[model samples]
Target: MPSSDDVYSQLKDCVSEITKIPRGEITLNDSLSGDYGYKDGPSRRSFAISLERCFKKHGMTIPKKLDRDKMEEAKKLKNVRDIVFTAFGV
Candidate 1:
């Protein structure tokens, strides 16, 4: 199993791809929109879908509850770390 740090790294990489922000410049606490350019609900929703795929690609499984439509469930994940923790545990 991958460690939490590895998971975080994967997530960071994905966000970097989407936002073009350097991974080193992003912190786990940075909000998806406020900080990293996921500026709206649709984008966040898309991100959630991409995240599900990302986890799958890495042989991980994101719980269904955390992956909800329109980002309803994921909205509470106000930052990168919160998303990872909610998906994989902290």
Candidate 2:
């Protein structure tokens, strides 16, 4: 199994790609829209979906409840770190 840190790193990398947010610019205190230019809530939703696709590509699956909650709570994540920690449990 991958370590939590590894998972977090992967998530961060993939999220960066999906959100068009640069690595250094991503923080735990930034909202996807305000920080990453996500114009609407659906963009954040798509981010989560992209994350799930990434996870599935790696032969993993985020728990359904957690996935749903992650999708719902995307805007509340303080930064990239917060999202990674919450979703991947790092």
Candidate 3:
């Protein structure tokens, strides 16, 4: 199995590609809204979808509630490390 670090790195790469954010620009402290500017509902929803897709690619799944919440909770999901920790339980 891939280490947590490796999984996080892959997630970061996927997020960078999906969001069009540079890999170096993303960090464990960055937020989806405050840092990445995913302010609108549509943008947030798209972000949530992208995150789900990334998790699926890694053989993980987040709660369906994430979708129902309009991805509002995802705003708290700062950085790649948080994403990996949440999805993989690492």
lDDT string for model 3 (1-81, tens) is 456777677767777877788999877667777777887777877776787777677665543323425365566445435
* Tens digit of per-residue lDDT, candidate 1, span 1-90: 557777777777766766788878866567665674667777777777777777777677765544444363343334535655666766
lDDT of each: 0.64, 0.61, 0.65
Compared with the true structure, model 3 gives a TM-score of 0.61
**lDDT by residue for model 2 (1-90), tens:** 557667766666666767677877665566766666665657666666777787777666654424544555566444434555565555
Q: Rank the candidates by TM-score, best first.
A: 1, 2, 3
The window of 10 residues in a row where model 1 has the poorest summed lDDT is 72-81
lDDT of 2 at 13: 65
Choose the strongest candidate by TM-score: 1
- In terms of TM-score, how similar is model 1 to the real structure? 0.63
Clashes of 1: 0
Could you give the candidate ranking by lDDT, starting with the highest?
3, 1, 2
Q: Which ten residues in a row have the lowest lDDT in candidate 3?
A: 61-70
